[model samples]
Target: MAYHRRYSRPGTNRTPTCDKISEILGSADKLAGEYSFGGRADTLPPTPGLFVNGVGMILLPLVSEHAKKLIAKCRQSRDRPNMDMGKSWLQSDQVEMKNPSWQAGMEKLMKNIARGTGYMDIHFTACLTN
Candidate 1:
């Protein structure tokens, strides 16, 4: 999860703790991504590590200690996320977005994430079971 908003627009839900929108991106079993941007209710801007999935510039704790541990583990492991897989996944979505600005913004955001995480590519497919 990650969040870094100083102020929220009107009509949005207000929380006493913070006004940011915390996006918890995770798979069925574990969390996703190590972020250097948000880890607290009050992480200010100028965040160079403000991206979706990548090598984190610094571990600011996207969600919890688990995330930090996972990040460290992945870093140490020889296995790395497949860049092409993630790009394939996002290509269609980007086209669907239609708006040029939105598309560009998303690309930039993901690029930042990738850069920060040093290869935050993700393309997960799971078998379901109860």
Candidate 2:
């Protein structure tokens, strides 16, 4: 079976764990030839060594490891390999964000909250509630 893990702080879930995300991405990398995967979350397809039908998301314990890499991949043109990864994320609704600045701000806040101690529940308030 495919590994489905969530990397978050010991008792908090604000930022995404990038390292863990990277590991997951690496694992998923093993599966890049089996399934016709496509999207930001679809980093790698199931291959001979990788498992099939195994997919997951990273959004806790730490910032998403692939966050930067994914973003970089997203920014890449379609000519590049895996360049469409970002597009898949958007098509899959995994990234339901329209504004880049807004998303960046939210990511920054999540990182800060994850690092420090504060009631930073983004869902509770409409705006910054720290």
Evaluate all candidate structures by whole-model CA lDDT and list the values in order. 0.39, 0.41
**What local lDDT does model 1 show for residue 57?**
31
Q: Which digits, one per residue and each the tens of the lDDT, describe model 1 over residues 21-90?
A: 3322223113433546533332223333423234233334456754554344332212335553221222
Top-TM-score candidate index: 1
Put down candidate 2 lDDT per residue, 21-102, tens digits, no spaces.
7567667634433333233432222221211121234343335664554454333334554753444332233333233454
**Per-model RMSD to reference:** 22.5, 22.4
How does model 1 fare in lDDT? 0.39
User: TM per model?
Assistant: 0.22, 0.18
**What does candidate 1 score on TM?**
0.22
Judging by lDDT against the true structure, name the best candidate.
2
